[model samples]
Target: MPQRPEELVELLPAANRFLGREAEVGDPTERRGLVLVHDLAGDFDAAHAGALAGAHLLAALPHEVIARFDADSLVDYRAHRPRMTFSGDRYESFTAPEILLYALEDDAGSPFLLLHGTEPDYAWERFVAAVARLVQQLGVTSVVALQAIPMPVPHTRPVTVTAHATRRQLIEPYPVYWGEMRIPGSVSALLELRMGEAGVDALGVAAHVPHYLAQATYPAASLTLVEHLERLTGLHLPTEALREAAEAHRTEVDEQIARSTENVAVVAALEQQYDAFTAAREGTDLLSGGEVPSAEEIGAEFERFLADQDRKKPRD
Candidate 1:
């Protein structure tokens, strides 16, 4: 079991170029303009939007694994069991969990880093430290965290996002929603906070997934996330496939909602709320715009809905 941050990850030969190492690791005065994007897989991600966006990037671009984290030390097997194949009385094969860092080239041949895989079940602080070390050693200029969150939003409208950053200027175009509220913590959020404290530029985008469809796959949210990433980082990523999936998903969702009068009423009410907030364009949240359920209220009402989705989920 690796106990130290340096030991937790193995940097492959492919990573040497980023380390400013020709014969040995040394600091370079020149900026490499490297960006690191991390999307740790966990229940915190509503509708698995972050994971899908990361997957899409890997599929569309050229990349290579640069580092491999010690998953055995970080993961709790009982919490997320590994997959194994069985045939009668014989065990055939087992698939292990992975936390990998990849070095990828954008469409314009610009280089960046991507850290993706299951969220750690242990040693979160150490894991974060290890990544921080990598960011400094590999000359990463910025770190971006991709996330998805449930909100009282309607699928009929364009997807919305909550953008955040360590510094105000990094997310100047984004609106400031609420003052402060306590919520469940996730590793990605913590990383952003810590990175900010370290004087390193870190930012994140939380795509709003409709609270009602939080349990189901929503490609629109994923597409929106990727689009925002492109906007923020100037990365030319392919979104055609995700766009098609979202379009097809919208039609299916509409057909299903049309069958249920209750569901239709719910959507209409949400749409009205959405439109009112957009028209008035208040600094306050949608809930304060008028007498409609707030995102927090709707989320609380549907809390029970997502609870079982995790309990019923099969071991990884």
Candidate 2:
């Protein structure tokens, strides 16, 4: 049987055992009392953005440390299972889920929780129950989940964030807007629900990134979420470095777009759709809906483009 989360934390190997690996622990006595978790899969760029933001916040808070999980420790027995109802290919790998725990130093306010990763392969409800048990063991008062959402917004504009909380009364004081659409089930969503049921405050912040740029790095979106975190948690995080990196990335993207006529044309078409959607949503409390292309649509377009390119390849 898997050990309890508290027991797992105790079992964590010391830094010395990992050689190059080291733990960045803030003042162990200060007690900032917060945790942040994020997913690190699907669209590596977006996942990278969330990870960067989480690392930056941990650095600024003075007493928070990055949560480390032993990915190798997870054991999933269903690795070779078919991917979908009609698919025959098996999954590449499978492992057990890990709960990473970090200690917040410096008497810094309530605990924050962040989660990032691709959709889980197992039961989300069970995952949430496990997280709730872990939270109780960690003595966390609140949890915050952060996610990066690819949208139709332009890269030139500042990324916007939408938030959702289990209890409106707890999060109403913050300058966050409620999510306009229904979010499907995921480990993070299940965690939030379980946290609320356990009487631990929980909220989710989703940072928007331009869909065209989802394949590329977008540190600007990361910085945007960091700013929101500072406001919500009363912790200051330095974003100057992130801003500079984002600007550099934007320049590179612009240069690449300029060089590729096909990409330029696609971007232009996307821009027109974005403009129309934005205009329709302006001057009202109603938030933009259905502006972002679904994952299926993006995948289909990409597959078709790839097929065309393959056809154009020279005969060997």
Candidate 3:
């Protein structure tokens, strides 16, 4: 669907607020390059990991807020209840929604923009257009948005990422999507599409999260995103914190799988399917003689195994 003429210009006011704080943004020598956006979306809390990755970068680089969005118009207060704390005799303030634009610089002194926001419940188009306008004003050359999606893959296999971009050259290294797919829309998706239409370069990287680990914090995916960004933008970004966390999480997951033979079997089966899929994508004939299992079949078997394990567990 195309946006109305008024919707495009109406957001300029909010976007102008993004450029007004240049003094607080960063060093004048750092030239604006890319804009990284993270909208809390999908399963596996990958959005949280992406946000933490952004935060870690901000900690290492000089950064400041460029703009702030009004939560009252975008958020549903009832769904996100702010917690109140008591300190001494005074009541502490509630935790409000944080929808912010941050101006940051990398180790190479190339500046970039990072936008982190709670997925809005209202006026998504307006919010997205406002961000696009801000990107144009900031002289950002490219936009990279991060998202993590749950797939029927195993944690034992290396995490795969799907790249979407306005131009084919930007994602030449990644596998091309051939089939038509439809999923629930997100602000990040809209922003990328609108930016592309506005003649701005935009790319989206979707980290594949194992369906079973969708609810867990997977720092491995976070580390992968940081590394990919470095290669894409040629900017050195920090990933030590996420790396350490990923190693610890890997150990925990391994121990849990070791406890259950069923889990181990399921993982092994999934690993085979993953390897076959990988080989196929690489234009290999590794699975020519053997039968390649469908993702649905693998996912169904794992689900049954989990159900059986749950039923056998002692109830409280």
**For model 2, how does the per-residue alpha-carbon lDDT over 148-247 read when each residue is reduced to its tens digit?**
7665566654566666778887556434423244433456667777778877778767677676665556888888777666666575457787888789
TM-score of decoy 2: 0.62
Candidate 2 yields a Cα-based lDDT of 0.55
Ranking by lDDT: 1, 3, 2
How well does model 1 score by local distance difference test? 0.84
Residue-level lDDT for 192 in candidate 3: 83
Q: How many residue pairs clash per model?
A: 0, 24, 1
Q: Which residue ranges in model 1 land beyond 4 Å of their true spot?
A: 21-29, 282-306, 313-316
**Tens digits of lDDT, candidate 1, 225-302:** 888898899988889999999999999999999999999999998899888878777665432132234557745734
Give the whole-model CA lDDT for all candidates, comma-separated. Answer: 0.84, 0.55, 0.66
Please give each candidate's TM-score: 0.90, 0.62, 0.77
- RMSD (Cα, Å) for all candidates, in order, is 3.6, 9.8, 7.5
Q: By TM-score, who's the top model here?
A: 1
For model 3, how does the per-residue alpha-carbon lDDT over 191-216 read when each residue is reduced to its tens digit?
78988898878886766667677656
